[model samples]
Target chain A: MTAAALPRTTVDRRPPLGGFSLTYLALEIRRVLRNRRSLFFILIMPAVFFLLFGLPQKGQNIDQANSAAAIAYIMISLAVYGAMTASTATGGAVAVERAQGWSRQLRLTPLRPPAYVATKVLSALSLSLLSVLVEFVVGSIGGVRMPAHVWLLAGLGAWLGSLVFAALGLFVGYLAPAENVMQFMGPILALLALFGGLFVPLEVLPHVMRTIAKFTPVYGVGSIARSPLTHDFSWVAVLNVVGWTAFFGLGAALLFRRDTARV
Target chain B: MRTDTLAASETTGTRTPAVLLRGLTKKFGAVTAVNQLDLRIEPGEVVAFLGPNGAGKTTTIDMMLGLARPTQGSVEVYGLAPTEAINQGRIAAVMQTGGLLKDVSVAEIVRMTASFFANTRPVDEVLERAGIADIADRRVAKCSGGQQQRLRFALALLPDPDLMVLDEPTTGMDVEGRRDFWNAIRTDAQAGRTVLFATHYLEEADAYADRIVLIRKGQVVADGTASEVKALAAGRQVRATLPGADEVRLAALPGVDRAEVRGETVLLHTNDSDGVARYLLTQTTARDLEITSRNLEDAFLALTSGEDTDLEGVSR
Candidate 1:
């Protein structure tokens, strides 16, 4: 066949910069929401943790504050933890897509690499927001109390803080084997949660552990999320978040560059 | 020879060919998957890339599609870099396997892909055109290999691409499935789409491609039309029944390359079966004579199997 024989119905009409298609995002969001396992991890698991740990101590006092304050503190921490997990898991789904050779398929399309990466980050953020919302609802029903300003600021902080873990998830997704990514990320995120004071207060830990926790990315998110109620905002925690976000963001970018260079 | 077809396509104004490869080479540590190869495929021509396993067909295709960077040399699609052509929706591909998400329904996959294209055919239209409309709701994992392939074709059609590259697109299909798949491809090609397909099936190339490019050990050993490639191998066979046939004398006959005896029949492999047939009829007491030209499979084996021959001379 010659060029003259080509069907006139199909012609070149490509737009400049095939980036962030709403339809594509909607489909991806639908796929993620329909995944029962992802839903359980992102929503149910954190709510369960909040109910088990925070409900019993609902009326107790901590740090010279009402028991409600203590419940609110735990609620915020678990919410941040859930957001972080959801974002990281969403990023890690890249491993499965890579294994399925979907990346190669995308290369053949009009979608640019940067656009693809942006879509993934946005999807992760969406899921992270849902995780935070689920924890917030559970906390509200369980009688956890906080000022309106604190709820707004802390929830926003927690959701924004998850960006670091989302970047880390992308890095790990590109670096690790597809089948073992979740297995590899689960324990690693769990350790970060513990050391970052999501499970227990950093003040209760030994001096060395507390010092080390200050450097972990999640410590910054936790501190920032709880600062409104605790009335303490550490510069070190803020710097930790910024520093680790850059670190993981660069790592993910480099890995993505390398991965695309490979056949 | 169908050289006129290749020439006719090349002379069509100032338009760039769909694909061009120059001194393309790919190496993996100590192993070289593709050597210094050059090829130009004009727009609207259907070319079949044929080779044995590990013959660098996939590697070459990868380089052309921008899935892999060449260790040396360069590739261009429609006068632009491959990635640029792809981003412009000038090119699209349907790979052999592993490109589909098995968990998603066929319609979902098509819709997702369509979203990436700036100008796509209607989703239902593409599905129906690819003959997968009935199976659109089926999960990709539940669909048969042929059905999954049709889905891939649907995805490729989303961009309304001018150049379509397929790497063994019908690898795991039944006979009916293969025929159905080719019919769709043929319809697309006849509409003037440029197609480059790599396949192990010689008959598919013979029946569909206007040009056949045979590669061996990372280099093109033969490039021509199907009949031209077939003629490169030992030409044909001349068989006849002659009681107590003398195999040695038969082998010495003009145009005969080798002679063998089976039961009451004498089989002669020849470069010119016409010469052998004429000689058999006039000089020998032969009965039930038959002359058959070699098929593409024979041509493929003959062109690729021999190790000592300098194939570079035959590559054009």
Candidate 2:
């Protein structure tokens, strides 16, 4: 009506590809950051628990020679715990979205389909990395310090752990019916993480349970993460962790895409 | 099916249609949600699509909005393929659920969605237009159902799109809310946007739409102005109290299609019962006669009444 600026309609028709990517990323980050509960899950609860659990058990609890080595093992094992947290959070979120038709709404939007899976996995990775970073700082203050190399190893293990469980979480998110998402997701992750040695070391498991754990993805993630702490850096364990992550991620993505075709 | 012939047919007073769908069919597995359907909508017009539950109105809207693909035929919005054009940011739709993100506020939702269009209406003006300005700060999840509908209206108005398609926009709204919502739509139509709406409330369409199109079993059975459609519902009915009325003679009269004699009341159904009543008054000793014409409800019932609707295949 008055002397004015250019209207936004045509201006919005095409932003650069990067801008669209960032928009999708921003929307996801914004939603996750808005709730106090997600903040607690993302920052406080994991970091505090990792510190409380990692300090006292740093050296004497593991029978390892050096405190650095024992601390690394604990840090690596905690990656599995981080993965479990992501799985539970994301699984619950997706199931809630399904119930409230939020997933259907997202499907209708112009957001690229692959971006949905990619964004959640990456967000979970970033969060777990932050959690492990906090745990390392706390471990240092609590009379456990590692060489710079071990710190770098902890970051990598944390990210890899995030991917493995995020993919698992995505699968469970889709497969569980909306009503029982909590009931199913919690027990499944708890049992798998326990057997993978987050709550109990693999050395303490019974013979049958210990053997069965070798085939599980949690075992793959935990063993790889633990190798970083022990400075073992087993190539086979690393490959197994990465391989299962890709397999689960792809399977979950295809399932998500197929279910949304109607939506 | 020929566009040129249809265009030729279009130019002889009706003008080129704003939308045309020829044999629009969409099937998911074995369910043919939108069967082969042919439909045309014109510019500066409002059309209401009416059908029973699971009658494929939402499926048809989905195809038209380019959310889903057609299995057998094609759909065009203003002569452009719906999918490609909508992705390019042309037509705008207000869907069920309002398509509003729960975490975002009403203002943020409008601002983000409006960024997708060029020559978009101003954000503040759209806020006022959708009547959500008072609670623009409210999260979409926190708004009342009707306020949520208005926020969606704001989003649809952002692009100032040539065509606006709404599917069950007023489903969970209160009466005044529906009124305010349609009032905003009427303003959009006044701005020359072609408005297409789907509703189970026959009266909503009757009040706002310039024309009503009723679909049954995935096909268009009636499409015309309200009165014209009403006239097609076996037209009007005329009942007369005639003194020993000659039922056979009246049944045989011009323009009178059917007649029933019930005691003193002689009932006549015709395409033009008014004319029939005039003729009857002059020709017989009919004491008291009442004539009534079909309304949109009657027209809707008449068209959908014949189709086989099992409501089996459509999901919600």
Q: Per-prediction fnat values?
A: 0.74, 0.13
True contacts kept of 1: 0.74
Candidate 1: stretches off by over 4 Å: A1-17, A65-68, A203-208, B1-16, B72-74, B239-268, B275-289, B310-316
What is the DockQ score, from 0 to 1, of model 1? 0.60
Best by TM-score: 1
Candidate of highest DockQ: 1
Q: Local distance difference test, per candidate? A: 0.84, 0.68
Error of 2 at A33 (Å): 2.9
Best by lDDT: 1
Q: Give the per-residue lDDT of model 2 (tens digit) for A54-152.
A: 665655646645334455566556655665565446545666666666555543344444656666666666666655666556556666666667667
Clashes of each: 6, 6
Residue A168 deviation, candidate 1, in Å? 0.9
Model 1, span B1-316: residue lDDT tens: 1234355454776666678888889999989989888787887889999998899999999988888889998899888787777877778899999888877899999988877767778999989989999988998989999999989999998877788999999998999999999999998888788999999899999999999988877877777788777865646878899989899999998767689999899999876787888888898899999988788988898878866353433443
lDDT for each residue of candidate 1 in A1-263, tens digit (9 for 90 to 100): 45553444334445456555877777777778888887888899889988888888777766665333788989999999999998998899888888988987887877778888888888889888988988998999999778899899999999999999989999988887575588778889999999899988777999999888888999999999988878888888889999999999999999998888755
